[model samples]
Target chain A: MHRTLHPLTSLCFILFFFVIALFGAPTTQMVGVMILLSAASSIRKRKQAWKKIALYILPIGILLFLVNSAFGAPFSRGLAYALRFVLLITPLVIVLLGGSPTDFRLGLRTVPIPSRLHYLFIFSFEIIQSLRDVFQAVYIGQQLRGYNANRSLGNKWKNIFPLLLPVMLIAISQGLDRSLAFEFKGIESPAEKIYLRTLTLSPFDKLSIAILLLSSLGLIVASFILP
Target chain B: MITIKDLSFRYKQEARNSFEHISLHLQDGQALGVIGPSQAGKTTFAYALAGLLQKHFRGGSLTGTVIFDAQDQAPGTSEIGFVFQDASLQLSGVTETVEEEIAFSLEQFGVPRDIMRERIEEQLSTFHLIGLRYRHPKTLSGGETQMLAIASEAAKHPRLFILDEPTQALDADHVRHLIDFLRVAKRSSTIIFIEQNMSATFELCNHVLFLENGRQQFLGTPHDLLNSNIDVSSLTLPELIDVQRSLGRNHISLLFKETIEWMKKCRTSA
Candidate 1:
């Protein structure tokens, strides 16, 4: 819950929770745990909590319930699988909404991914953000240029299509041009080296990592014994 | 310093040279102001000097030599840095933070670990961006973004800085900051400024070079260029320059102190 957790540790915790939920025993228990995590995050930021559950988590839960009811096999078994999916996704949603974009990049840096791929990831993220802005701007521009009655649902959707395609293309081209400029500025040059100072692993990181290791080990032992 | 002798260039698709027989020289520590109507090759000349005409761009045939700091140099020489009119095109950072944006280039040079953090921190404070170091570059006001670009390039410490109408995206306040920043650059580096804002040009540059229709119309000290027999009404000069011109004041000194003294002389003579 503390914001002081290193970005890497937060990422590790989220990934670890999902891996266990997807692969460990008692899927329903994992699902409950996931929902609990999301509910906890929601307490801090109510709107984000509502959005995560409503948009992705709730729909997933409903689908699981329908499937379990129809199949009706170890009724609890179906419920458990559905619960697992919900639990698997909760930590991810919490992490995504918890920090600003820079923290996201910093977390990614802690991973073993290549730097070029990192640049592309950053570039795409900006492109998406810019595309959203461009569409809104174009809509405002359209209204200002004399298209008044845009209140009706059908008219609004139609207005969006015309606005969407052009903005999307412009955003794509702008992204490419910016990427080329970065290349010209030598962002891709391997010869250009940066010295990264070693970051000390904090107690929070050690604890989260320990929890992941212990749970994963427990799952391995239980699966062998139960099998 | 730049000297172009009988220089001519034509884009591959175009029929004629954009400019022919062009020759000009910019002195050290002097700010050169280039003015011309559109399609007059104002940007083309600036590009040619930076060697970007052939390096960064194509579809042009250039036959001329460009000398930088008394030495012939190729495109993107360490001695010269360029600023386009569009600040967005030049800045490369997804994060909104100004410090991260300026660090983009220094990181490229592989600046020593000992200096990187200090340099980044210094630029953020010097450009009045300390408080906004964490703010997004895309969210920054037009002037702040321009200042960010200037700050980024300044960290490189290029000897010759060429700004191609950098004030176009800026407002009155930003324009002044840009001029003031250039005044600081002029103290240590020669600057070639191409702008339609003559008032800005008059305020900062002592040396003026006028380009009209891709031809060098006038090149001299600001005093002679404006005070001579020239139709400057189209130039839309600042009110001060207009009054000086109407009165036939021959010495329109560019130094702020000198201009103040000249104003006294004009009032006394009248």
Candidate 2:
């Protein structure tokens, strides 16, 4: 809910949620706590709540639930596993859309981590984003150019590969090209860097991070105590 | 100024050279339009100029010399700003906003805070990007993204700027603005423009590099190539040039408006 927190603080909070979801027992208490966090995020941006649920969170959760149950896991356990996925993913969605994108690399850079690792993180992230854009662009371009009065699910399904192959090929080539541009911009240089705005965590950021830590620890302890 | 002599290159495991025995001298403060059809090695040539061919593009037998700033620099260096064909891919993935995108390289170079702020402001206004300064580059229109890419590179103020088909995704108005920007840029930096839009290229570039099938077919002024009896329909020749070739009209126009005005004059005179 605190949108103006330092990007690094936001990152810490998101990572805390992820670690909790990944490692914590799938008890009612853990799920309830994560649900509260997600609900707060959704309530903050009510307009995007439906889209986050329908497009990303719910479908993935449902798919995982189905897979787990099909593999002979008990119904309750499968449901908990699915809920955990949703919980872990919620923090990232909340933070990205809640405010301006975190200066993620800079946030990571402020730590004792080496520059090259952050560089790799930033470069790889961009490449993935670029590839996604290429695929989307190809799909949109195909739809616009091949504007036919198609009225069948079968036709739409069949049309997918025709668009996908070119997108894949273009994405691959562009990825390689971008790697070259990455070095061209002297990103590989070991030069001292300056940011447009250096990140300085406020007292509020520290408080938020502290609260996130306590909450995560409390949920873990509560998970064990609940049963 | 740059001199590239006896340049010939082929990609790894490829049987043929993309371009062979190509040689040209780019003068200071000149815009040379590099035009060719598909698969004519325009992108390859652009890369070579940028100095990427040496290390970035691996396992290629590249011979000859590319001398810029009195040094044999690589394509991806600071001296030669090569705007890739796809502006979207070339974007520094770290920046969240258009302002950040423009400031990205400046930050990398550790440019002083005061100067960086001044440069970002100037670029935003110059490219008509003031309105979209806070907007993310990924969400920008095709033309706006392209302009932002150019502005980002221009802020670095490279000695030689080579753009590979920058106008491909742009509309007429954006293309006009880009050309106008290039006109001013040509006063300071030598520009190697790889473009498909012949008329626009002709409008901005004085020297032309016309390639056909991985070879240099013609290297001269636009007027020289236009006046020559070369039959290439795929190339987007201006209507004025076509009329000049057919009729005895000596009219010169690289734009539709100019062509229309010339036609009216010719009709009235007749």
Top-scoring candidate (DockQ): 2
What's candidate 2's DockQ score?
0.46
* Model 1: how far residue A220 lies from native, Å: 5.5
Candidate 1 lDDT for residue B33: 86
Predictions' DockQ, in order: 0.33, 0.46
In candidate 1, what are the lDDT values of residues B201-258, reduced to their tens digit? 8778877877766666787877788667765555767767666656666765445666
Residue lDDT tens for model 1, A13-50: 67666656666667536554755665455444657766
| Candidate No. with top TM-score | 1
Candidate 2: list runs displaced more than 4 Å.
Answer: A1-3, A7-100, A103-106, A114-116, A119-167, A206-227, B73-76, B229-234, B249-270
Which lDDT tens digits does candidate 2 get at residues A70-155? 86778877777787887777777777666554645456656666666776777677777666777788777777887442758887
Candidate 1 structure, TM-score to reference:
0.82
